[model samples]
Target: MNKLIAIMNRVLSLFCISLSSILVACVIWQVFSRYVLNSPSTSTDEIARFLFIWVGLMGAAYTLGQKRHLAIDLLAMKLENQPGKQAALKLIINLISAVFTTVIMVYGGGALMLKTLATGQISPALGIEMGIIYAAIPLSGCFMSIYLLKDLLDNLTDISSSGTSTL
Candidate 1:
């Protein structure tokens, strides 16, 4: 499990880095074309927007897996030495996050992508299928779900052993 999670973390990190690099390049080209060349590239703006979405979503998933995502731990801090309660709280939090990510980002985003594809929607500037750009939503949601599952299982194990939450 640890190995799988480590592999996932590496893949997500690479994915986000690649997308971010492309996004930066696109923005640079757009800026250079607009100011230096006196003409902006038509597709760079749309491409940058799409890449931004992918990079942001994947980066978030990577951060979540790294346990580096922002979290308010006031209640958790209060729990302190109560390993069982803290573990329970962590489990509940992971469960809630899993449900929300599945329902909103996965299901809803999938539906939106399918509907757009069905309508043959395309981006104006890039002439690319809009559904392709929207694919990031459900993909990131799935990644988040995986991380949440791992956290959930870890919390469960901690509860069984009366250990502090590691998530």
Candidate 2:
């Protein structure tokens, strides 16, 4: 399990890094083409915009795995028990997030992903298939949901082993 998680972490990390690099490179090229060449590449703006979404979603998943996402702690800190309930409350919050995202994955993203099998949607610039790009939404959601589940399980295990009330 640990090895699988580690491998997932590495793959997600690489995926995000590559997407980010592409976005950055596209933006840089866009700027160069407009200012230096006196004639911009028409696809530069469209490609960059599309790649930005991919990078943002992929990077969010990476942050989820790295446990680097910003979390509002106002409620968790105000709770009664510090160590015990804090973890439990956090798990509940994560569970809620997972459930919400799962719904979006099913309803909103599912149409975009599963039903667009014959999609011919193309990008304005590169004429790239938009369906392929939009596929990242559900894909990221699945990965993010997995991270939440993993976090919840870890907290549950900790509580169970320690006989804590929070779990």
Candidate 3:
């Protein structure tokens, strides 16, 4: 499982880097075309925007997988000496994160993606189905949920092994 997660993280990192490069190149092209050529490229703006969205979402998932997402951690720090409390707090946090990511992002994003697909709407400049662009939402959500589940399992294992009394 850890190996799978590591591979996924690496893939996501590469994906984000590629998207970032694409976005930068597109923006540069757009600027050069508008200022130097005196004609703005119609497709570059839209393409860059879509790439930016994907990079942002994927980068967030990658960060979460790395366990680098922001957290107060004041309570956690305070509870450091209390193994059971620390484990319980970690479990609760992971549970909440998993539910939010799964319900709001994963399930909701999936429904939205399907509806957009059925509507057959296409981007004006790119001429691609809008649903394809929106797919980043659910894909990132799944990645985040996977990380949350792994964290939850680790916390549970810690609780079991600590042999400390329950909170």
Candidate 4:
């Protein structure tokens, strides 16, 4: 199980890194074209925005693996013991986050894809299918679900290991 988690983390890391590089490359190209070449890409800004979205979504699972999400710690104060309460709070938060992601993935993703497909719209520069780009949402949601489940399991097991202690 630990090995599986490690592999998942590594895969997520590589995925984020690769997507980030694409974003960075696009930014560099946008800058050079706008300033140096004096020929701006009309679609550069939109593409950059999309890439930013990709990085944000794709990096989520990796951040979860590292426990690097921005979170308020005050909730755990309700319980007496720090570790157990923290674990419980984290599990709740992760579950809620996963559900939120699922909602966005299902509705927002489907709407975006449907709109683009129906309107015959495509990214100006790449002319890529909108569904291809919009796929990031559900894919990331799935990735996040996996990470959240892992976190919940790990936290619950931690509590179990601590031996039915009060908190």
Q: Count of backbone clashes for each model?
A: 0, 1, 0, 0
Instruction: For residues 10-57, write the lDDT of model 3, one tens digit per residue.
Output: 999999999999999999999999999999999999999999999999
Sorted by lDDT, highest first, which candidate order results?
Answer: 3, 1, 2, 4
Q: List the residue pairs that clash in candidate 4.
A: none
Pick by lDDT: 1 or 4, better one: 1
Residue-wise C-alpha lDDT for candidate 4, range 15-74, written one tens digit per residue:
778878878887888899999999987676677888788888778767866889776766
The sequence of per-residue lDDT tens digits that candidate 1 reaches over residues 1-167 is: 78888899889988888988899999999999999999999899988999998888889888988899999999999988787888999999999999989999999989998999999999998789999888888999999999999999988888989855444
* Number of the predicted model whose lDDT against the real structure is largest: 3
Q: Please report, in order, the local distance difference test score of every candidate based on alpha carbons.
A: 0.90, 0.78, 0.92, 0.76
Per-candidate RMSD vs. true structure?
2.5, 2.1, 1.3, 2.9
Candidate 3 overall lDDT versus native? 0.92
Model 2 RMSD, rounded to 1 decimal: 2.1
Q: Which residue pairs come into collision in candidate 2?
A: 43-125
Model 4, runs deviating above 4 Å: 43-46, 77-82, 106-120, 165-167
Off by over 4 Å in 1: 163-167
